[model samples]
Target chain A: MSGTDDNAIVAARNFVASLPHCRALGMVVEAAGDGVATLSMPYSEALIGDPGTGVIHGGAISALMDTSGGVAVLSHSTGAAMTATMDLRIDYMRAAEPGGRITARAHCRHVTRSVAFVRAEAFDEMPGSGPVAVANGAFALERATDP
Target chain B: MKRPEPIQVVKQRRDAALRALMNGVPYIRFLGIAFDRRGDELTGVLHYDEKLIGNPGLPALHGGATAAFLEVTATMTLCWATLWDDLEAGRIDVATLSASQPTRLPKTIDFTVDYLRSGLPRDAYARARVNRSGRRYASVHVEGWQDNRDRLFAQATGHFLMPPRA
Candidate 1:
């Protein structure tokens, strides 16, 4: 697929917009370029599990990585890709600040007949110094056949 | 505004949903996932408490628990989608399992996690999204954020294969 395929990016954005939680969290695709896609999700209080003390849950971060990496592959594949995370390892760099926007940039490093590899990084744009999280992902793409 | 209902009632409903969602998973019960039914969407939350601390030094939440939360959220989304009368619920039963069926059962083939932000003392919030294509399988995106700060603490994306039940 061409890097400037507006149709593919629009389809991906539409799919994400249809999700309730993604809407609640304010997730949006900022841009798509050359085999790379950038997504942003805002923080919401309803997303917090512990109200007393502020702590962003780990599960939320995983979602961002998945979306970023999946979209990265989708940009290059002709058919839809079904990502099966073979393995995932995370290193906590630091705690996120309250009410900050987390932005992720994902790039496809390699793609073969069935497997695709991607790397992503997410960080707060308010300060935007060091990254809050970095991820490397592998996904399997299933080519769709014409009926 | 007044609190909705008794916490017990809410807890019971969440437990039932979790049990129906997956089989042979003991940690879902142990973690105490609470479900909120809003129209068609089923929202589940794993409340943070003192017991959630896995390591003393960094006090990171257990990775397994985080993974379970992601898997369950995806399963719940597929389950909720099954309620539509026009859709075949049975296919979904297999699909949901396939969506999360790890390449290696009870073992992670590959996992990449990022810590976007950290929480202060206790508690965090996690949100997940599951995307399914036709009836084959699904992909889930989960994010964990420190409760107070809107910044994400960790994020993960997972893929599961759904094959017809044998």
Candidate 2:
């Protein structure tokens, strides 16, 4: 990796560190590269949807995907600025297993002057069965003027 | 649990039921969302907490929080409507229903959310409309607003699985 790529990764890390909800949800930044980002959410009792099944709630998966999408925007941008989710469509493929960390990987597929599009997937264990959920999202970017 | 009482008394019962919903759902209750009941209409309110901030630089509420709020609002609205339907039929009492009731939670099958604006640091309100409900599934539209209802911060549509009645 070049110095420029290194700086962008650091910037992305800083931006992720500043998200209060990410910390509250116990989400961590695993890796970030050009137009790509990965995030993980640890298992928590607070995220359980069914007591009998011990399955994680679908809402928790939605949160993970949305946050991963936002992080992808940071990875793709030259300078991190304010970006908010414009829209997101999530499809639940299967119920996430309890007591396993959920990992979300997002790719910033496209970015224009005002909007960035992201595609993401979440899974408990990758290279295993398949994704638990898939998402497509658009985010609005508020870019800072270059000096 | 089917009993007909005064309208005011019934309203109180329904309100208590809604309150119990807010307290029972581990996730919705975790976010501290409360319901405001007006006759047959219900609105969900999510009070701003420091923990809800997603972007410290923007000081905005998390997008996930907004989505979750809207989703919860949609399900709660459906459950509320079911309670009224049961009450009108005089078959089930709304006041007697608990969170553990089978029909209390509507499992989300699909969800789509559109965020029109940043979720600024403030109390957010959401209202849901049951677009179509059948025996096994229900579709709902939910809108979230902060300062102005006309200018919504986000809108969502979802399909939920409806369990068979007991």
Among these predictions, the greatest DockQ belongs to 2
Worst 10 residues of 2 chain A by lDDT: A74-83
Give the Å error, residue A5, model 2: 5.7
Which 10-residue window in model 1 chain B sums to the lowest lDDT?
A: B102-111
Candidate 1 has a DockQ of 0.06
Candidate 1 residue-wise lDDT, A1-147, digit = tens = 454567767866875565443454467988665567888887766444323234354456556665667677777744544444444554435556767777888888988777777788878765747877677766666666523
lDDT, candidates in the order shown: 0.55, 0.82
The interface root-mean-square deviations, each candidate in sequence, come to 14.3, 1.9
lDDT of 2 at B141: 100
User: Which stretches of model 1 miss by more than 4 angstroms?
Assistant: A1-5, A49-53, A77-82, B1-166
In the range B1-166, model 2's lDDT, one tens digit per residue, is 9566788877777676677656556777667788888888999999889878887876788888888899889988997787676665657665455544533467788899998888989999999999999888999999999999899999999998885677
